[model samples]
Target: MCAFIKVSIATFAVCNRISKVLGFDDYKFIATPVVLLMLSFSIFVTQNTMESHFSISNIWQYYSFPFEAIIPFVVFIVAEIRRKRTKVL
Candidate 1:
Protein backbone atom coordinates (compact mmCIF):
# COMPACT_ATOMS: atom_id res chain seq x y z
CA MET A 1 0.00 0.00 0.00
CA CYS A 2 2.78 2.37 0.90
CA ALA A 3 4.54 1.50 -2.31
CA PHE A 4 1.44 2.07 -4.36
CA ILE A 5 0.84 5.44 -2.77
CA LYS A 6 4.42 6.41 -3.36
CA VAL A 7 4.25 5.31 -6.94
CA SER A 8 1.01 7.13 -7.52
CA ILE A 9 2.39 10.29 -6.05
CA ALA A 10 5.54 10.02 -8.10
CA THR A 11 3.67 9.24 -11.25
CA PHE A 12 1.26 12.12 -10.70
CA ALA A 13 4.13 14.48 -10.19
CA VAL A 14 5.88 13.30 -13.31
CA CYS A 15 2.71 13.32 -15.36
CA ASN A 16 1.86 16.75 -14.06
CA ARG A 17 5.19 18.06 -15.22
CA ILE A 18 5.17 16.29 -18.53
CA SER A 19 1.63 17.30 -19.35
CA LYS A 20 2.43 20.90 -18.65
CA VAL A 21 5.43 20.73 -20.92
CA LEU A 22 3.52 19.01 -23.67
CA GLY A 23 0.71 21.58 -23.48
CA PHE A 24 -1.65 18.76 -22.77
CA ASP A 25 -3.01 20.55 -19.75
CA ASP A 26 -6.05 18.37 -20.10
CA TYR A 27 -4.01 15.30 -19.23
CA LYS A 28 -3.15 16.70 -15.86
CA PHE A 29 -6.68 17.98 -15.41
CA ILE A 30 -8.26 14.68 -16.31
CA ALA A 31 -5.68 12.78 -14.29
CA THR A 32 -6.44 14.55 -11.03
CA PRO A 33 -9.90 13.16 -10.46
CA VAL A 34 -9.09 9.73 -11.78
CA VAL A 35 -5.97 9.43 -9.69
CA LEU A 36 -7.73 10.70 -6.64
CA LEU A 37 -10.59 8.29 -7.05
CA MET A 38 -8.32 5.34 -7.61
CA LEU A 39 -6.15 6.26 -4.68
CA SER A 40 -9.16 6.62 -2.46
CA PHE A 41 -10.55 3.30 -3.56
CA SER A 42 -7.21 1.65 -3.13
CA ILE A 43 -6.85 3.06 0.32
CA PHE A 44 -10.30 1.89 1.25
CA VAL A 45 -9.65 -1.57 -0.07
CA THR A 46 -6.26 -1.75 1.53
CA GLN A 47 -8.08 -0.92 4.73
CA ASN A 48 -5.15 1.11 5.76
CA THR A 49 -2.97 -2.06 5.10
CA MET A 50 -0.47 -3.12 2.52
CA GLU A 51 -2.63 -5.84 0.98
CA SER A 52 -6.13 -7.25 0.72
CA HIS A 53 -7.68 -4.36 2.46
CA PHE A 54 -10.55 -3.87 0.07
CA SER A 55 -13.27 -6.41 0.25
CA ILE A 56 -16.24 -7.17 -1.98
CA SER A 57 -18.56 -5.73 0.59
CA ASN A 58 -16.71 -2.45 0.72
CA ILE A 59 -16.59 -2.08 -3.02
CA TRP A 60 -20.28 -2.69 -3.38
CA GLN A 61 -21.32 -0.78 -0.32
CA TYR A 62 -19.26 2.35 -0.63
CA TYR A 63 -18.20 2.88 -4.20
CA SER A 64 -20.50 2.88 -7.19
CA PHE A 65 -20.25 0.84 -10.38
CA PRO A 66 -18.77 3.65 -12.44
CA PHE A 67 -16.26 4.89 -9.92
CA GLU A 68 -13.38 2.82 -11.16
CA ALA A 69 -14.14 3.20 -14.81
CA ILE A 70 -14.58 6.96 -15.00
CA ILE A 71 -10.92 7.81 -14.73
CA PRO A 72 -9.73 5.64 -17.57
CA PHE A 73 -12.56 6.61 -19.83
CA VAL A 74 -11.89 10.29 -19.26
CA VAL A 75 -8.22 9.68 -19.84
CA PHE A 76 -8.88 7.95 -23.13
CA ILE A 77 -11.10 10.75 -24.27
CA VAL A 78 -8.55 13.33 -23.34
CA ALA A 79 -5.82 11.33 -25.01
CA GLU A 80 -7.81 11.12 -28.20
CA ILE A 81 -8.43 14.86 -28.09
CA ARG A 82 -4.76 15.46 -27.57
CA ARG A 83 -3.91 13.14 -30.39
CA LYS A 84 -6.26 14.94 -32.69
CA ARG A 85 -4.93 18.30 -31.69
CA THR A 86 -1.34 17.18 -32.15
CA LYS A 87 -2.00 15.90 -35.63
CA VAL A 88 -2.84 19.40 -36.74
CA LEU A 89 0.40 20.83 -35.41
Candidate 2:
Protein backbone atom coordinates (compact mmCIF):
# COMPACT_ATOMS: atom_id res chain seq x y z
CA MET A 1 0.00 0.00 0.00
CA CYS A 2 2.72 2.45 0.93
CA ALA A 3 4.79 1.34 -1.99
CA PHE A 4 1.86 1.98 -4.30
CA ILE A 5 1.45 5.50 -3.02
CA LYS A 6 5.15 6.18 -3.28
CA VAL A 7 5.25 4.93 -6.81
CA SER A 8 2.20 6.99 -7.77
CA ILE A 9 3.72 10.15 -6.40
CA ALA A 10 7.00 9.46 -8.10
CA THR A 11 5.20 8.76 -11.33
CA PHE A 12 3.38 12.07 -11.10
CA ALA A 13 6.62 13.88 -10.47
CA VAL A 14 8.23 12.16 -13.43
CA CYS A 15 5.23 13.03 -15.59
CA ASN A 16 5.49 16.66 -14.67
CA ARG A 17 9.16 16.71 -15.60
CA ILE A 18 8.39 15.04 -18.86
CA SER A 19 5.65 17.49 -19.66
CA LYS A 20 7.91 20.42 -18.97
CA VAL A 21 10.76 18.99 -20.97
CA LEU A 22 8.55 18.25 -23.94
CA GLY A 23 6.68 21.54 -23.76
CA PHE A 24 3.44 19.61 -23.36
CA ASP A 25 2.16 21.47 -20.34
CA ASP A 26 -0.73 22.75 -22.42
CA TYR A 27 -1.49 19.29 -23.80
CA LYS A 28 -1.81 17.17 -20.69
CA PHE A 29 -4.38 15.09 -22.56
CA ILE A 30 -1.53 13.85 -24.74
CA ALA A 31 1.31 13.69 -22.25
CA THR A 32 -0.77 12.03 -19.54
CA PRO A 33 -1.55 8.88 -21.49
CA VAL A 34 2.06 8.57 -22.57
CA VAL A 35 3.27 8.94 -19.02
CA LEU A 36 0.71 6.38 -17.80
CA LEU A 37 1.76 3.88 -20.43
CA MET A 38 5.39 4.26 -19.46
CA LEU A 39 4.55 3.87 -15.80
CA SER A 40 2.57 0.71 -16.52
CA PHE A 41 5.47 -0.70 -18.48
CA SER A 42 7.89 0.02 -15.65
CA ILE A 43 5.63 -1.61 -13.06
CA PHE A 44 5.00 -4.64 -15.24
CA VAL A 45 8.70 -5.21 -15.78
CA THR A 46 9.57 -4.71 -12.15
CA GLN A 47 6.84 -7.07 -10.98
CA ASN A 48 7.78 -9.84 -13.37
CA THR A 49 11.46 -9.64 -12.57
CA MET A 50 10.89 -9.45 -8.83
CA GLU A 51 8.27 -12.19 -8.65
CA SER A 52 10.55 -15.02 -9.59
CA HIS A 53 11.84 -16.98 -6.63
CA PHE A 54 15.51 -16.76 -7.49
CA SER A 55 15.38 -13.09 -8.41
CA ILE A 56 13.16 -12.02 -5.51
CA SER A 57 15.87 -12.08 -2.89
CA ASN A 58 18.39 -10.48 -5.21
CA ILE A 59 16.06 -7.60 -5.98
CA TRP A 60 15.09 -7.22 -2.36
CA GLN A 61 18.68 -7.10 -1.28
CA TYR A 62 19.57 -4.45 -3.80
CA TYR A 63 16.40 -2.36 -3.82
CA SER A 64 15.10 -2.69 -0.28
CA PHE A 65 16.07 0.91 0.51
CA PRO A 66 13.29 2.53 -1.54
CA PHE A 67 15.58 4.29 -3.99
CA GLU A 68 12.58 4.96 -6.20
CA ALA A 69 10.97 6.95 -3.44
CA ILE A 70 14.09 9.00 -2.93
CA ILE A 71 14.58 10.02 -6.54
CA PRO A 72 11.47 12.14 -7.00
CA PHE A 73 11.74 13.46 -3.48
CA VAL A 74 15.23 14.71 -4.25
CA VAL A 75 14.07 16.14 -7.54
CA PHE A 76 11.25 17.95 -5.78
CA ILE A 77 13.60 19.44 -3.22
CA VAL A 78 16.00 20.63 -5.88
CA ALA A 79 13.18 22.16 -7.91
CA GLU A 80 11.82 23.94 -4.88
CA ILE A 81 15.22 25.31 -4.03
CA ARG A 82 15.69 26.60 -7.56
CA ARG A 83 12.27 28.19 -7.51
CA LYS A 84 13.02 29.95 -4.25
CA ARG A 85 16.38 31.17 -5.50
CA THR A 86 14.78 32.55 -8.62
CA LYS A 87 12.09 34.30 -6.61
CA VAL A 88 14.66 35.86 -4.30
CA LEU A 89 16.73 37.11 -7.19
| Number of the top-ranking candidate, with lDDT as the measure | 2
lDDT of 1: 0.72
> Candidate 2 at residue 55, lDDT?
61
The CA lDDT of each predicted structure is 0.72, 0.74
lDDT of each residue in 1-89, candidate 2, tens digit only = 99989877776677777778888756455557866797688787667643765666676667755666778789899999999999999
lDDT of each residue in 1-89, candidate 1, tens digit only = 99889987876776777688878845556577666877797677566543454555565556555666877789899999999999999
Model 2 RMSD in Å is 7.2
Number of colliding residue pairs in each model: 3, 0
What TM-score, computed on C-alpha atoms, does each candidate reach? 0.33, 0.44
